[model samples]
Target chain A: MKSTEILNSLQVSLTIKRLCHQLIENHHNFSKSVLIGLQPNGIFLANRLKSNLEISIQDEVQTGSLDITFFRDDFRRKEKPLIPSVTNIDFSIENKKVILVDDVFFTGRTVRSALDAIMTFGRPLSVEFLTLIERRFVQNIPIKADYIGKSIDTIKEEKVSVLWKETNGKDQILLYSPT
Target chain B: MKELSTSHLLGIKDLTKNDIQIIFSTADSFKEVINRPIKKVPTLRDVTIANLFFENSTRTKLSFELAQKRLSADIINFSASSSSLNKGETLVDTANNILSMKVDMLIMRHPHSGAASFLANKTKTVIINAGDGTHEHPTQALLDTFSIREKLGSIKEKKVVLIGDIKHSRVALSNIFALQKLGAEVMVCGPTTLIPKYMSELGVKISHNIEKALKWCDVANMLRIQLERQQIQYFPSLREYTHQFQLNKTLLDKVDKPITILHPGPINRGVEITSEIADSEHSIILNQVENGVAVRMAIIYLLAGSINRV
Candidate 1:
């Protein structure tokens, strides 16, 4: 595998800080705006954003974890049963400005599925999306993101990995292409 | 990454520990889905299911129907009493007629053992055994075990006793297979005549004493006497049976440690278990019913996950 480092540890931290300030600038105090992390990867970014918001805004911020396994269009189309992560959204999203966060944006199908899955809890006033790495020119579905840290163009065979300190030893984003 | 080992869910014996875990984890997700305000999903939107009931059922039938509807699958219900089975049509003929209508899957409940297996052999569609006579009620067993795990966390190293008529119960048979496979120590306590002779070979403890069984178990899964399936009297009378084996509050209170209680429903009140015990916090009977829908959804979802549309 030929890997290209998209963002290193220090670069990743700076990008997250920028994203946190961007969120604070738009939704001041985050009283009406709720941050929701997509399950598995997005929660890590969501939590970091939440903690950063709490530190800067000097108040608690509400964030929830959402899983979209059941709402996926490829339910019966898969070779094996799709495993699901935990979905724990206790507070109602009704009329709240929902900021959906994810690790990387590739096909945009996950965003579409997340949009549908969030509707089950309550009707949000509006849904905005944020992602760490937004791959360019590879979207299979039409989805627009409100916040993006970095964007890149890659071949279909290449895979993008956003490693977190929780699972990985350090934080970094890399694109792996076939040699 | 785990898939069901077999295409058709004929019996618990046909499933491996990995398969059971797969179903349980899938059911865990469905549990979250059902708890939400909008409980339905569009996973099986394109598939059609035929619920064929060759026997009488209220709980199992409704549970399966609710599960299919939650997954957004189309269904056509058939009760054998109202169908052409009364007009001398065979079971195969009835199933074939349904399958010929382009039914994508079949959920069946029949009065004969191996009816689900027979249908699986004859049909190309996936068959989920919703209680075949004296054989297996795989989903019920799954939900029962699921309730135990939900209430008590894990089934491993736990003492689970199945209390009731074992000879005529498909639920008991399926539960035995499921509980044993999950590493729980199983004990079947009932009348000697009601206990099957082959249970000893299965390695579960057999006890004729319900009180002693209660003391020995961490979980008590009380089963109904199944009076309808009882062709001959296993015990002298209902009074005698109740006297010997009824799980009332007194029997429950006698246990030194906290014990989880489970009953697969259509529960015979005051017979196998008293109303007090059934309504107590220790009992997860209603949880078993609610989990029935979620667990069946998981079973159907996993079984139908890989089917290629024709």
Candidate 2:
């Protein structure tokens, strides 16, 4: 296999700081908006963003984790059962602006499933997507990120991976292709 | 990334300690989901599950169905009385017909021991044993232990007693395996005939006297007397059984420390336990029922995760 690093730790950190500033420009108070990290992969990114955003605004931001394991369209297609991650949304989402965060944006299916999963809590006044890396091509669903750290163009065979300091002990984005 | 060694939940004996921990932790997450304003999740949206109850069930059937629905799986209910089983259709044929309709998973409660395991070998669909005859009610054991862990904070080193009919209870057998596996001390308390002769071989302590069992236990799981399974007279009369074995507030009050009371219900209120004790603060019977849904969800979610893996 062949791999390429797109962003190192310093670049990733600077991108997150920029994202936090941009978030404050749009959501100054965040009184009506809540941040939801899609489960398993998105949780670390969501936590980092929540921490950064809170420090920048000097105000607490409500955050929770949502696992869409049951809501996926491909669940029946796979032979192995998908182990579910914990969903810890103690607060209601009714009429609130919801920020859905994830490490990478690919086919947009995950975001679509996250949308369906979030409605169960309550109807959101608006929904926004945030991603550390966005693959500009290969979206099966018509979805785009409102807050993107970096957008990269890639072929269908190439995979975009985001490694977080919380999980991988380093912050980096890599693109890989079969040799 | 660790998965259950077995594909189907046939019995408690098939589960290892690690399997139970994974299940309990998964159930813990689901327990949180059910308490939310919107109790439903969408993880099983594309999966279809059929609840096939060859035995009559209120709690097991309803709880399993609720768990399936909350996971967003399409559900179909098949009770033996309402189906072609009454018309003499074989279990295999009935199950095959359901699978023919593209059912992904089967949650079964059957009257014969090992029925779920037997059917599991014959089908490609994942099978979960809700309960099986006088053999093993794996889910009941799971929910019971789950409820116990929720109330007491853990199942390790807890003193638990299974009281009433032990010979004919699938619940007792499964609980013995589960509780013991989780590091709890288990004891069987009942009459000689009702308590099996070979139960001692299963590493369970035996107590014939109800009062002694109650005093020794931190949790007393009062099982319903299976009158239907008794072909011959095990005891002289219901009066005699109640007089000797019935758990009431008076008996419970006499214990030095408060002991938790559990009963797998369709409870014969005045027989195994009085209404006062069943309704008391010491009872976790209803909590057991509530936890049943969460535990079943966890099991289904886990099993479904690996159903069609490449």
Candidate 3:
């Protein structure tokens, strides 16, 4: 199977900037809110959003990265389960609204596991989901994104990989089918 | 699907049969790597690992650092004395700062129990607890098992005697769990105060007489007695304990069967074990130290795989 070229001429940085503006406008009154990025690419996107949010709010917004490897439901199947990256949230999350940011949303298992991992720290007033891309598929749980940059229809065999210059040396989304 | 990658190695008691097998098999692969001339691999190449040592250590810290280096991973050593953590910088802040550098794993040895787990919660790095107060030293136990398996073939139904300061030794606590899981009959012998009464409930027999325990065991593991832990006066005198509990050549004669001697160093020399027994042909004490690197390399390789995939 050949991978489809859905993002052949896409401008990811522009889309991300526009998404940051939308998120800031949506929660302009939040004072102590934080942005928690899920591991790997989500963390990269979250850090980028955090810098942009900090400039717009003119205040220091707490930014953290979370790794959900141990909390995953399918951990038993991975041959070489990578050690999770660092999850760093220095401040308290109790009674404060949080935006759970990620690069892409698929079956929502990662998000579900992220919630389980987050609850171990403290209870939050509410958690809003934000993603750069959302796949058109049935989620295991009734979870929806509060802010989405783009929505793409994909099949089970298809994969959406997000590459950025900060880590991957490029900014593009690839739709690949395993050969 | 590897079960070892998904769970925190906080204690050996929680390990299943499969978990033990995975560690053993992984260590076997690492042993081969140790024998190679190059003695290095790209398994963890480009990954960042941090060593958070809140307590001063020579053996454990160096073994872990060497293990990470041999696996081709970048390592950052954080000594508590020099770290901002000494100036009341919170553990969270230290972790956050290291996280910003994108560390893939954190190997920690703190003076408090559950300190590694606390750091695990704060960071995405896989936490390998080196030693937390007197709580547990999982890697030491794992390497001991590796040493035993190399010598004895199998630990199933083997009589393993653990002699020394049972109450204050983290190595003793971790060995009990590892040995029991591998099907060894573990017995701990020491002064009355040092040997907890309810230890049999943890599947270990407590004996005050080393002579009795020696007669019935295939393997004898001796633990170092920390002078600091004696402030509470657990024993009447160190001299008395040494005379009765120390495993010298004369004590080795009590065992009729072929016996192996093990210890987590630096040995007390004349306290828990004598120079004769420590350097004896039956001693695997040095083997335990050599195996520590291989065992730690296995851990870092398995855990760092997650980060490289990113």
Candidate 4:
């Protein structure tokens, strides 16, 4: 596969700082809002944003990790079994604004699943989407992100990957294509 | 740990230690999901599962149904009493008729041993043996071991005594197979008629004395006397059986250290176990019921997953 480093480590940090600032500009103290990180991949970006947001807002924002494995529309289409991760949201989301976070915004399927999943907790006052990379011109659902880190045009076969320091010992986003 | 090699979960004998570990961890995640405000997952929304019970059951059937619902799968429940089995239709015919509707999986409970295995071979759909005669209730055993591991933290080197009717109790048979495979020492304590001699060949010790068994073991898994499956009286009377093997607070106090108690309900209160012990802190009966849903979900999810991996 051929790959290009779209965002260097330093640029990634700056983009995250800017995203945190933009999040604070709208949500303020975030006392009425909670952040939910989509499981498996979104968790890395969610954790980084959650920790960074706390530093900017100077208050604790209830952050949780949710696994949409069971909620996916195509969950059982393939024979390969999907291993479900733990959905750890100990607090109630009733009447609070929820920000569903993920790494890449491609088909909008994960966000769709997250939307159905969040209802089990309680009815939220409102729900919003936040994604790190909004890959341009690819959406199977009528869904868009409220917070986006970067938008880039890409082909159908190309893959966008976000690496974090906590999990992969680096902070970068790469776009990979078939050689 | 290795994933289960077989797509169908007919019995504990088909699972390895690693398979149990994988199921336990998967159930652990499910347990977390059930505790959340939103108890449902969309994973099995595209799949349809049928719970086919040819035998009478309350807990297992409900548990499997609840697990299926939680996974957001389409569910159909069939029982012998409500179905056309009274018209003399064979089990295979009934199953194939249901499968013709495009059901993706079948969970069954029957009065004969290997009944699930028999159907598994006849159908391409995934078959899970909820309980099959005196053979093995794999899910119950999985939940039992899961409950034990959850309570005591581990089963390795732990002494578990299966008390009461062992001959006809499918739970006891499955538990023995699963626990032993996971490195736990197992013993059967009951009357001579109830505790078969061939059980010793399976590598489990036999004990007729309940007091000795309780004192020696770290966990006592009390089993009900299945009077329904008995053709003749296995024991003389219930009073005599209770006198010999009943577990109350007095028997529990006799042990030097506190031992965890497990009973796959509906409990024969005051017979195999007294009300005092069944409701005590040492008993994980309710926990077992709660884990039942999670374990069933794991089994269904994993089996469904195996189909695609192939």
On TM-score, the leading prediction is 1
How high is the lDDT of residue A18 in model 1? 97
Top of the candidates by lDDT: 1
lDDT of 4 by residue, B125-166 (tens): 899998999999999999999999999999999999999999
Question: Candidate 2 deviates by what RMSD?
Answer: 2.6
Interface RMSD, one decimal, each candidate: 1.9, 3.0, 14.7, 3.4
**Native-to-model Cα distance after best TM-score fit, residue A175 in candidate 4, in Å:** 2.2
How well does candidate 2 match the true structure in TM-score terms? 0.91
TM-score sort, best first: 1, 4, 2, 3
TM match of model 3 to true structure? 0.64
> Model 2, residue B110: what's the lDDT?
92
Q: What is the lDDT of residue A87 in candidate 3?
A: 58
lDDT of 4 at B306: 56
Error of 2 at A118 (Å): 1.0
C-alpha lDDT score of every prediction, in listed order: 0.92, 0.90, 0.80, 0.89
Q: TM-score of the candidate numbered 1?
A: 0.98
Cα error, candidate 1, residue B57 (Å)? 0.7
Q: Put the candidates in lDDT order, highest first.
A: 1, 2, 4, 3
The list of candidate 4 runs beyond 4 A from truth reads B1-3, B306-310
Segments in model 2 whose C-alpha atoms lie over 4 Å from true places:
A1-4, A157-159, A168-170, A175-179, B45-48, B82-87, B122-124, B306-310
lDDT string, candidate 1, B1-310, tens digits: 4767889899999899999998999899899999999999888898999999989999999999999999999999999889898899988888888888988899999999999999898877899999999999999999999999999899998999999999988999999999999999999999999999999999999999988998999999998888898888788999999999999878776876778999998888999999988998899989999999999999998888767733
Q: TM-score, each model?
A: 0.98, 0.91, 0.64, 0.94
Candidate 3, pairs of clashing residues: A76-B1, A82-B305, A82-B306, A83-B306, A85-B124, A86-B124, A87-B123, A87-B124
